[model samples]
Target: MRKHMFFSWAVLTGLLLVAIGCSDVSEPTTPTYETNLSSDEIKNSAFKSEFPLHYETYLRNDESEIMTEYGGSVNHNKNDGVNPLPEGYKYAQPYLKNLWLGYPFSYEYRRARGHTYALKDILEIDRINRFSEKAGLPSTCWNCKGTKMLEWTDEYGDSFWVKDFNEFREDVDLDENTIGCANCHDPKDMELRLYSVPLKAHLESEGKNFSELPRNEQRALVCGQCHVEYYFQDEKFGAAKKPIFPWAKGKDPEDMYEYYKNTGDTNIPGFEGNFVDWVHPVSKTPMLKAQHPEYEMWYNGSHGAAGVGCSDCHMPYVRLDGKKKISNHHWTSPLKDPDMKACRQCHTDKTPEYLRERVISSQEKVWNQLLIAQDLSVKAHEAIRMASEYTGPKPFNYDELMIEAREMCRKGQFFWDLISAENSAGFHNPTKSLDTLASSQQYSQKAIDKAVEAASFTTARDLAGDIREIVPPILEHSRELQMDPDHMASHKWFEYIPLLPESEKVWEGNERLTSENAH
Candidate 1:
């Protein structure tokens, strides 16, 4: 009996040791992976044979049909409320074209596709002027599109940024150059490394090194390389058109706004010290356009403060072969999965439906407030436009009052854009989102009041009614529309922009076209 018990005990001990070994396979770990590909490999296909599962999952970025309540992979017009399906979504924002009248964004702004389409979308996007040989933008626009930037920057150095965006069109390969493996990886050993020059510069400025950061922090920083807010460095500072994150003061809206106060060489009155992205054609306000700032929005929020990295939710670990777990390469909304598997990883007790409802509920409130703020912003612009054109006797302090109104209009619109441009629909930071919108509304109202005061109350009655009726949303505008005299005459604001000369699209994707190939 004693001998039999000893043998059973030994068997149980051996089983325990085997279970311990298998447990490591179930959790994600940085196992050493050796791919013989060059350290310079930027092509997605180069890593396919070596890491088949990861490559397979990465291809899922091509699935653009899926959508959640507020966001999805569908490449629809974000400002189109009149169209259906692939052309538009139910929650479209109507004021986008009006808000961005003078900017390239007014031409065509659509909901983004997955990262795999980044190169293709940017090439075809109406925001880039394709009709002209000159792209009308700096090469800096290509910074976030692909891994080829790694090669381009290496070859051209600082001069790469100021080059015409169209200069490199014929040299890029869509599939290979689209954002992929090499962007955040060291091809030598599959370790995380920072490839974005701006992100690296920002970190180093703060005396932080990417390698020294905790692994969890490194995961979020990889996403931050492209996801954070940035501006092209004005020539006065250093490298002209080079992108720089305005995180010197802090990551919050007010902090970045403060940092922008003295970053540019724009000598326009009232905008002397400010970094101006563009001057609003209608309001004549110096504006700051916020890019998609997911990283900034999430940084100090609930999940971020609690130590959740971007990958923890967007790229949850899953068993592809039903054995070893890997971080899913298909980066997308956590709510996209019907099971809410990513959320369940942390909130194990909550049902998927409950969590989803909570998210949509927060978004609904935010969306409503966002519309209100946008309406006020439109009213402010109208007020300023009227005040600028007023012919009656002006107040003694009219110049000062008008400057204050313009400043308010600038701040209000920027605050609105911060939330509007962010992809999360306020789920990333609901408190910050709602607060910013509320502040935007107040600033817009103040802008209207100051504009009226500047005009000595002459514009109050004109600005009092429903804003939608006052300035109907510019439902359609594009490079094609600008070339048509009738279309340019259709709107009062269209007068601010000169009509484009008749021209054919000179380039599409990576292909430069002759008349035979032009569309």
Candidate 2:
């Protein structure tokens, strides 16, 4: 009976795909609303005066990071957009390239930029272009980049996920679609409303619903829409694309590890366990990439325990003109603000200098350990590669041992990502950050130990000694890893001018394009 039911569903899915292919109507093929409210009605209900729906307006009026060089946050002096790295941020791309050599991230993954650069950066990234001429990427890439996503979701429905990313690039108006005020703003009153499909679905599976949550919880939920880790679950389905959050068990880094370890195939409803994002080329282990999980980190930290929302620290309210006050929507580090006023609001006893040092101290500690984790992880990969490739006598089969090593790498990288991928540099929850890093260190060392044990099975016993010797030199093997040391030296592709000329510069490299559709 179960087999028959699945067969029936497969047949229905096939029929639906056939209908989609045969139709000439390529525009959004789905209903826009679940209720009687039209788009205008929904807008009218949420906003009164015209809400500045475009983010460019805000960029022009107030938050001109390009114009002010993020108010000297970029490089300790006001200059331009081409170099936006904050003070003390060192280039880690060469290290990451070794870590993710088998994955597309190795092609290009820079430190994240402000919200305004979201769409432009993604469009310009080399990872997306590696196969853009052929397979390209899935539409899921557009999920957080722009406000056009909301419109595309309403128009295409489930079809949105299944379509090639290039399809939307060709079909939609990219310029007007960049993420803007309309995304989180309610058109009627400008109150925040959740629009993330994955967040809504994940919450439902966890036995909670977004709409029913209190205003405060909703604040966190709003951030969770894009900040949480997720994976594409229905890739094999071909016709249905689903981005699922593996939060059935919980949101902790360990909880997510367990969820990914035990969750089965998409055959199961609501839970995707034992998923594989990509198999590591060098480690040969099935791996999962951790997205920026600020929400999850904050959830496990002191602030969250104290019921402090993300906005309390990252987005603080400020008074201007001595009378009018509003929540600062610039969304940057509170410590970087001119006076450290946000921290003062909470810790009135601390001076701005002390608070700056406090945050920087925590970040430096995590950053240093993160590099150690990177070094150890790279060794784990080399160890596995040596063990598997050893051609000396007794051609040992270390399949099980390799599996063990991969699991360690899995946990190790996950923990590293918990700190490294997270937007906050450990300041959000210093204790949790350190604890997570300790786990990464432990897991990484275990992986190295397991790899050594496996390599000992080599027919030439001396090969085991050599494998041990080989592991220590992995960090210095950058040339062998095919990673270029000069990866961070160039930012020539970046455009720094804000609001003037009304459009940003074109990429101008191979297929160089602008955030707007024009060349």
| Candidate 1 ranges with C-alpha deviation above 4 Å | 1-29, 515-519
Residue 442 error, candidate 1, Å = 1.0
Best by TM-score: 1
Top candidate on lDDT is 1
Residue-level lDDT of model 2, residues 175-244, one tens digit each, is: 4445555566554444567778888777776798666787778888787888888877644533355677
After the best TM-score superposition of candidate 2, give how far the Cα of residue 396 lies from its true spot, in angstroms.
7.5
* lDDT of each residue in 423-490, candidate 1, tens digit only: 99998999999998999999999999999998889889988899888898888999988999999999
Candidates' C-alpha lDDT: 0.90, 0.61
Lowest lDDT sum, 10 consecutive residues, model 2, at 492-501
